[model samples]
Target: MFKTNETQMQIHSIRWLKVIDPDQEYITHISTQFSIPRNFIQTALDENASARIQCKQQATLIMTHLPFNTSSKAEQSVSCKSFAVIIKDHLVFIISKHDHPIFDQMIQYVEQGPEHSAEQLADYVYRFLELAADQFIVASKSVNEQISTVEHELLSSIKNKQVFKLLNHNKVLNRIAISLRGNSKVLNLLNDMQVVTGHQAAQHRLLNVMVETDQAQAMAEIHNINLSNLMDAYSAAIENNLSLLVQYLSVYVIIAAIPLGIASLYGMNIPLPLQEQPYALSLLAGLSLLLSVAIVIIFKKRQII
Candidate 1:
């Protein structure tokens, strides 16, 4: 059954005895039933509890991180909040600070079981954690695809179309990294729990999940690094292109200035060497053509054109 506290799902579980408050009566009841210390129960019930594994006189009390979706930005962040307690063969409890879709789904599956065993209960918890890992994998894959798309666009000739996409890709990568780190912590906690319980199969499964997650994280990191490098290379290429363009324009400017300078000098209306010669205009034109050809030859020789 689901309980509400301030409009948030207070507790979710299948065959577990859930206690929201560690008050006098609640503590006394759990203590009597489980032969456990009231202090241990109280500590477990603390909302500000840390992830830990504690052994009581009667049961093994474990507090582990459970994944939750708590992102407020375009990129979603994964968060972990305390979830369950396994008190011996008779009792299991799940508590949450808020509604969790993963735990809720586990509850539904457990309810469908005709009878429950301690092994089944443990397996259910493991399955919930595995499912959480699966979600992370899904999110990582989605982000990776997005990065690939953005990288392709950035590499193409359409700079205007790719700029916004690249920015969004970076944002997504950052968010995914945050979520991956969080999920990794939870996965480690789960693996540690399995080790403590001596559940070899669960440990193997958890390790596999961790491996998959690490691969995804690595892919995201590599893509981010590659994209940054590509951007730097593109910027350098653009700078080189601009330098070549400036050099070409400078040569043209010098060539064009020669004609202007000659006209300006002749416009003084003073006597000049070829002012009244019969073939002066033709000779001047011919000299100008030769000079232009010489400039072209110089540029070609220097490999500047």
Candidate 2:
């Protein structure tokens, strides 16, 4: 899907180009229309591209990651989406692979409108970046909650399935952490842009964007460490639990073998002395029971159970 919105500000025009799941045909059309490089378009279209910032063809190309949804809720998948912010021909161009909240907000903010000049377009850019940062924070919160739930489940019974779920959380947090790190760099570039931070209001907005990006980065880092530690700690704990169970089973077998050995000897044909006794059956049964009880009592005294 693709949509275009153009707002003619007093000093410059604001052209917000939003694309979602663009195919080859759509990418080609937008590339030719905005004179945006095909490489930039292709990179944005790729699902696994790394976060980056580049300048090409007299325009600033800002490509970074955003959290995206997937089909499965249980999986809680988080993938990266790319967006480019380019200013050219007295217009601002935002090229993205998916339709995002920032895109909608910018479109409405300009259409209905706040009054600003060509230079103030930086405010729009920074605001969008701020919202993008917020997305990461939001995702981290959800991931943290899910991690807590999985940790609880692991506590009750450390199953392979639960561990896998925790592993998935680890992977997701790593991705988010990497994304935020890259974005922190890209956002720093915004601070250096005179046009983006020319006015006081624009400057403040840019600072807020930077703060949000930092907060998001911090959240990702903290949760990632937590999840990693959790998996390791629980893995060792689970092994210890298994070891205790095996020890108990070994004790049980040793105690049980005593009675079995006594019964086996009585069954042998060579046991003629016991067979000749009038109360042989009663004596053998009594002897087996007494020995089994003694073994159990000895184990108890040693606290083997």
Candidate 3:
């Protein structure tokens, strides 16, 4: 029953159980072994779950979105997943669908640091939130870099690919913004709750987490607005370029049609003015050229080109 890839460690005076990508059967086993609320675990596993906190009996459940870098080093994009933390008196169970680098960082910090030895389960929760906020900051910086790259590329030439890239960045920013708001809500609730306020240390840590959460949220919002404006400007430029191209094409078509209309009269069976003249072909050619030039001059004076 314990054959799964779950990592159980002793952090300070509490037992930390980290479960990744657990099956329903394993979740049932964990729920039975640790007496955790099964519903909390299920809620965390949900892909569409929002950040929230709940208390049931002796267990407290904290759900938060964990942001991860879904892009490679050359490119930057962010994606979020929900994770659940169930805190009992001496046991802390963290359940998520996938492992995050933040978890490893948490373990390493606890193992190498002496200051956190006296930390409680609530402190770890705050630390997790702070780390998550830091990830958002990193992601936001990456987005800013990407926007610069896209702008440079657009200056050279605009293409469908660049438009798609902007749309993709917009989508990522939207998700990050939403996740940050949810995180802020959870942090606010935790800060006001008696469970955190009663403990001075925990309250201080919670306040720090709250500050980081707000910063991340603000960054996301600012970046999102900038991205929206960039997209709008790009679209307007593209439309203007297309309109200019059509105007030039129309000017050329009218110039060409003047020559064609003059030549077409010679095709008629009736006695045309230059149809029988010995120098008619040369005169007609000169007339067409002259008329085309005049039309161009008229268009230029009107600023149609």
Candidate 4:
């Protein structure tokens, strides 16, 4: 689906074109309409695409991954997806193969008001960038909440299942960290090069985007560190639990060994002092029980059991 929104206020010459899961026909149509390279259109549709920026002629293609809520039945529950914002001539093309909430937010933002064309392109692009950063912040909050929940569950019971879940969360955070960092770098480079220079308002918006990107990068970094630390702490806790279990089994074996030795010695068919006595069987059994009790008491006193 294609959503075309043109500001009637004439504050900006740039019109916004948002595409949702564009098919080949849609890609071809836009490619021909804006003279954008077919490769650019195809790349934007790619889900595995990375964050990047390139300018061709008067058209600039910025392919970046945005943090998204991963509620899909797919294997990955948390990850970033591509969001391409192409500024060509007098229009801005936002492409995505998936219908992302961030894009919906962008759509609402574009349609919410009308501004003069004075610096509409820069304004629109930066606004979308800010929205993307906002998405990252939102995604991180959910991820952190998940991490906290997992941490609580782990504290109650150290299950490897939760470990696997934590691993998935970490993978998600890792992706976010990479995407945020990459996007921030690209935005910083653009700022230094004055890629979106012109109207004071647009420049101010661009500066705001730079700040937003920095904040997003910092957020990603902080969460990644927290997740790493959580993993480390929980991993050690799991190992400690296993070690305690093994210690318990070892103590049990030692206690069992004492009773086994006593039974074996008595079971021997040798002519011993109590072998001729009528109460020899009961006597040996009593001795065995006493020895086992003594061993249990010793272990308990030593706090080894």
Candidate 5:
């Protein structure tokens, strides 16, 4: 039931099976054809699956989350998807829900020819891990740019939408961080298992994979910290702005009450100061204006306005 686009390659007498976005029927076929434990395959294809390695008598399964889609469109958020590689004797199966570009590179690597060994197979796995780490790095950079854009917008003027965008960006960064940590754990487990044993070159490549994974993890953490701080500062700023607004409104209310009080007194039928003066209304108006101006000037001098 495999599609034509799916590939099964024979390299140096070793069979390589690569499936892309397999369905239930395809999974059934793979399970029946290869006798692989169904859970091994399912775990790899599960969207929310974390990085893991499971060893059984029949097969060794290595699964890690990779950047699923890295479209540069501003509206699209970064995400990771599971990619699993299973090795049983001379047979290797690579499974993923999305046909990542790294798979293409692996196909080329397979075609280029190399002596097949556990190290070579491990190297194949390493390539998947390496590419995942690299993708995380790219995602971190993209997120940093987005943070900058949001910060710039905030600097010019604060808006509710921009704050919401900050929250969204932080969420993306947290996802990346969590995925990187999972991948790092898997890579460390692989190193401890010595899957590439006795091959110095492969071991070195594995070390690079570990280093890259750690670096990506570190970047994600740093971004998360910076984003957290930014959000805290933004919240503080919003509070400060609100406080200032309330202060200004209070000041204006007090200033307006002066005129209202004067008007109320003049409207009363009871005798008031200077009521019989011909220019009493004009005089009262001038008094209200002078008092309002004085109060405003006092607020300004006290740095309250």
Candidate 6:
């Protein structure tokens, strides 16, 4: 079930309030009790969320990005957006325009058992953040595998047939890079929140998340650079092959032109000095054969054949 902040609070237990708007009467009532700023509540309710931790005169404001799957592809990476304002001991408010699996799971947990403590709520938040980070690492590995496959195809056998596939891989890599960057920002915010909240355990966990994200980002960048270089190398190789083809064609043209030149001269109607000599045709044939042989030898010696 999707968790919306309109649920009523249970007796004295840590409340899981999901509100669509900070201006709602229910939200205002809680704000008064929790001493949370109306402005912070409003920002939390907005659809576009940023990673931030602000300590107002009233309560701590925590905004975090949660992962959600939007694609039908089996291996697709989930998209994420900010879910904000985890007010202290009393309320854990989250606002999101879309459904998230982890958030949904949390809601189920809450519904089945509504006895979650404040520390448990905080732990849940940290767990969700870690899950999101883990997803980033998983997505990175998928992208890396695709890159490896494409690179092998590009290097082992250069073919126009696979160009479209390579382009698609490039597009996927770009999307993964963008997601990684966003996840990195979220990790940084989590790290900062851990510091502000003095949650040493959360801080340590987030540090590991940060390290994994950085490693994934680095791998992505390297793969991208390698793909680009391979494309360039393929282009150069193709161009060199075309140049060699042209040179071979040029050599054939020169060889054929030699016989054509001899024919043209003999075709002239004017009586030439060798025309009257017996065996002149044989002599011309011998000379033409010698010239062809010489050309072949010269080309072979120059390594142009």
Question: In candidate 6, how many Å is residue 43 off?
Answer: 5.0
Give the C-alpha miss distance for residue 205 in model 2, angstroms: 1.6
Question: On a 0 to 100 scale, what is the lDDT of residue 209 in model 1?
Answer: 70
Q: Using lDDT as the measure, which candidate wins? A: 5
Model 5: per-residue Cα lDDT over 182-276, one tens digit each: 98888888889864443666678789999998898899889989999998898777667767778988999999999999998889999888999
After aligning candidate 4 to the native by TM-score, how far in Å is the CA of 7 from where it should be?
15
* lDDT (tens digit, per residue) of candidate 3 on 178-269: 99899899888887774432346767888888888888888988988998999888877766766787899989999999779988878888
Give TM-scores for every candidate, taking all chains together and pairing residue i with residue i: 0.49, 0.80, 0.79, 0.79, 0.79, 0.54
Worst 10 residues of 1 by lDDT: 5-14
Total backbone clashes of candidate 6, pairs 3 or more residues apart or in separate chains: 2
As a TM-score, model 2 comes out at 0.80
lDDT of 4 at 240: 85
lDDT of all predictions, in order shown?
0.60, 0.74, 0.79, 0.76, 0.80, 0.63
lDDT of 2 by residue, 194-241 (tens): 534456787898888888888888889889898889889988877776
lDDT of 5 at 3: 43
The residue pairs found clashing in candidate 3 are none
- Of models 2 and 3, which has the larger lDDT? 3
Model 5 residue pairs with clashes? none
What is the lDDT ranking, best to worst?
5, 3, 4, 2, 6, 1
128 in model 5: Cα distance from truth in Å?
2.5
Estimate candidate 2's alpha-carbon lDDT, on a 0 to 1 scale.
Answer: 0.74
Clashes of each: 1, 0, 0, 5, 0, 2
- lDDT tens readout by residue for model 4, 198-271: 66777787788778877877886788888888888898998888888889899888878876887788778886
Model 4 poorest ten-residue lDDT run: 2-11
lDDT of each residue in 1-305, candidate 1, tens digit only: 43332111212332454455444665576678667766666665554456566666756665654445556665444443554455564455554445556655666666766545544555655565566556656655665576566565445342444545555555566555555565566667756655234255545666777786677667667766766666666555556666777898999988877766776776787899888899977877777777887988988998978
Candidate 6 structure lDDT: 0.63
